[model samples]
Target: MSLQDLHGLLSNLQRNPGIPLDLDWVDSIRVNRSAAERRAATLPARRTVKKKYQAAWLLRAIACMDLTTLGGDDTPGTVRRLCAKARRPVRQEVLAALGAEQLGVRVGAVCVYHQMVPTAVEALQGSGIPVAAVAAGFPHGLSPFAQRLDEIRSSVAAGATEIDIVITRAHVLTGDWRALYDEIAAFREACGEAHLKTILATGELGTLTNVGKASAVAMMAGADFIKTSTGKETENATLPVGLVMARQIREYLDRTGYKVGYKPAGGIRTAKQSLDWLILMKEELGNEWLLPDLFRLGASSLLTDIERQLEHHATGRYAATHHQPMP
Candidate 1:
């Protein structure tokens, strides 16, 4: 289906309300790492979208991206610039050439430090783009439990409609599924109306089996979305890890009839990689998962590359990287 057709469906999507923790289901989860790796290895070579179709797919990627800025040196000015870019991502000239000006092309959200949520919210006002905040101690998830919940509340109070929270890796490491589930459930309650995106931080979770199990517990505890990483890990958002999580999402849907979104953050920096992820979602979860509501690409540099690709499509030659700056 066309991207335009998805706008309405996104508004109508039912939020994942969560269910009682089912240890039996969580314990039953498993993964074949070699098979997952073999399948992931074959994705890029197996499918390709070129020319005009490639441009369209890239545009969809832009719409599904969480245009992010999570640096230690981030300032109010930095966040404002990021919000401006998120609002107008692709240049108008490039969009006009592709006859997609009316596609209303824009990134899915502007992700920033909690301190900058109000700045992003103010900058993106009336743009219909939500502000996403990384909370619950973020990256490490080691803050005292009460403090983590307070951080979530503070961000939500700051007008962040989406909270991207980090899960305690220790819980998963020790196979403490119950602890993991309760923690996520409490975070979901604190989130209230704001969507809760549970970052699995899969990179530090030990194995693919742990990745699958953590994904199941997070979804079972009511995460509106399951994210692959905090973008801080040494290894983040690998295709094999993404595949395991996608399979878990599919299983959750089949059993509970609730759809949870998937996001692969960090290490995804090229336009081709964006298409690879889009293909993964489409092939694994079908067309519905391709929409921004159910899928998001959490990257800051990915947009610059995508804009460059779109510009290349609009004009036969590649433009200088300066022409497509992202904050």
Candidate 2:
């Protein structure tokens, strides 16, 4: 289906209303690192959609991107510029050449720090692009528990419809599953009506087994989505890590009948990497997971590369990176 059709379907689809936590299920989780790594290594060699089909997949990637700007120096001007790009991600000429102008194509959402939420909201006003804020002591997530909850509430009050809260890595590292569950559950309650994305910061979690268990815990505590990293980790969003988390999502669906979204942020900067993740989603969890609601790519430069590739596909010539700068 086209992006527009997918948007319509997403609007009517039911969000994952989380169920009560099942300790038995969370404790039973285990991951095979060597097997997962071997499987992930074979993905790039196995899947290759090219030409027009590749272009179509690129468009799908665009629709699933969380056009992001998360830096300490970010200002109102920068946030506004990012929101404008989120509104019209692809160049008009390129979109027209592909006959996708009427499809209303845009990125999944515009992500920013909590302080910049209002600026992004105003810039994307009436564009149907939700503003997402990284709250709950983002990146490290070391703040006091009460303060973290307060931050989520404050961001929602500031017009952020989606909250990306980070989990306390110590809870996962120390094997404090109950503490992890309680913390995420509190963040979910703080989110209220807004969708909550629990960032696992998988790079800091130590093992693939930990990543799988954290994924299960987050989903159990009512996370609308379970994200891979905060982009501040030493390593973020590897395919093996993604495969483990995606399998957890599939397992969650089978057991609880609730489908939680998956996002692999940080270090995803190329068009081919985006395609790899899409293929991972398609192969692991059907085409239904391809929609923006169920999947999101959290990156900024990734979009510029996708635009460049689409332009090359349209004009039969590759353009310099400087020609397609991001806002």
Candidate 3:
């Protein structure tokens, strides 16, 4: 086999493990971009509206998404409860229902800890909903690179399509841009065929300027997505950080012509807040940015509120009796 064939084979073996390598792994990873785009073409605006701004985004909240919180105060039982209360599985059927028009489930993907990749992988096997896993000693990047690398490999072994990694704050804070770049580049390599989302822990990054600079560096070092925070810091996912990161993404896209996705997670538990992020996307990136391809809200509690809003929209009044509030 030629060099390209070898590279492709190894990449696939690295991405899709368990089965012995026989066919071209690269071929398995190859996607028909045109076909995917054609199939995934956003539905045309079936319902027209005259309003300049709308809270229609509340219809798409991924409620009770149990992001693995390995940090203090977050437990496995908590995750189980959240998933139980969600009344949904990580199966592709569930993701299909979410993206389908019937119930119009709007969750982008189920976010989980590195250990739960198997659950999501099994649940979403052959499903479009990507299994997203947190890495780089998520909640904090204090762990060594070896640990982070192991996390990435394990998640990939468990079939995570996307890896969310935390950036080394000390390096970035100390103006060690090269170190930061290298750190992210390592993750990019470990990701192989999967998408990489680098988190800046924006709340701890101190300023909007740093957030913007960090976004640029992360994107430059090959981040397919630059997430705002890990939702475990003193504060997670603030508008200022979102605004800063979005502005930088717009700027970077303008300069490089590469559209990098953005995710703002944490504290976005209300429909109003979620819509506010959508509004930010609309104002900054225009109407085309409204899709989940380029934007996502990393939220755990926003769903019930979104559902409530959807109910309110469908009915004349919001019903508090039928809905049970989540912790």
lDDT of 3 by residue, 1-327 (tens): 211121112123212111121123212222233443343222122222222223234443342132333434645555455444433422233233334334433245667887666665565454345668898788778898998988987887788877899998987677676788778888888987777888998888765556766777787788878898788778887655666677777876776677777888878777667766766677678854555556667876566666665555554457582464553
The parts of candidate 1 lying over 4 Å away from their true place are 1-11
Please tell me which model should have the higher TM-score, number 2 or number 3: 2
> Taking the tens digit of each residue's C-alpha lDDT, what string does model 1 give over 232-296?
99999999998999999999999999999999999999999999999999989998788889999
Query: How do these models rank on lDDT, best leading?
Result: 1, 2, 3
Lowest summed lDDT over 10 consecutive residues: which window, candidate 1?
2-11
Q: Residue 220 error for model 3, in Å? A: 0.4
Candidate 2, residue 135: how far the Cα is off, in Å: 0.5
lDDT of 3 at 313: 51
Deviation from native of the Cα of residue 153 in model 2, angstroms: 0.6
Candidate 3 Cα deviation (angstroms), residue 125: 3.3
Task: Please list the residue runs of candidate 2 whose C-alpha ends up more than 4 Å from where it truly belongs after superposition.
Answer: 8-11
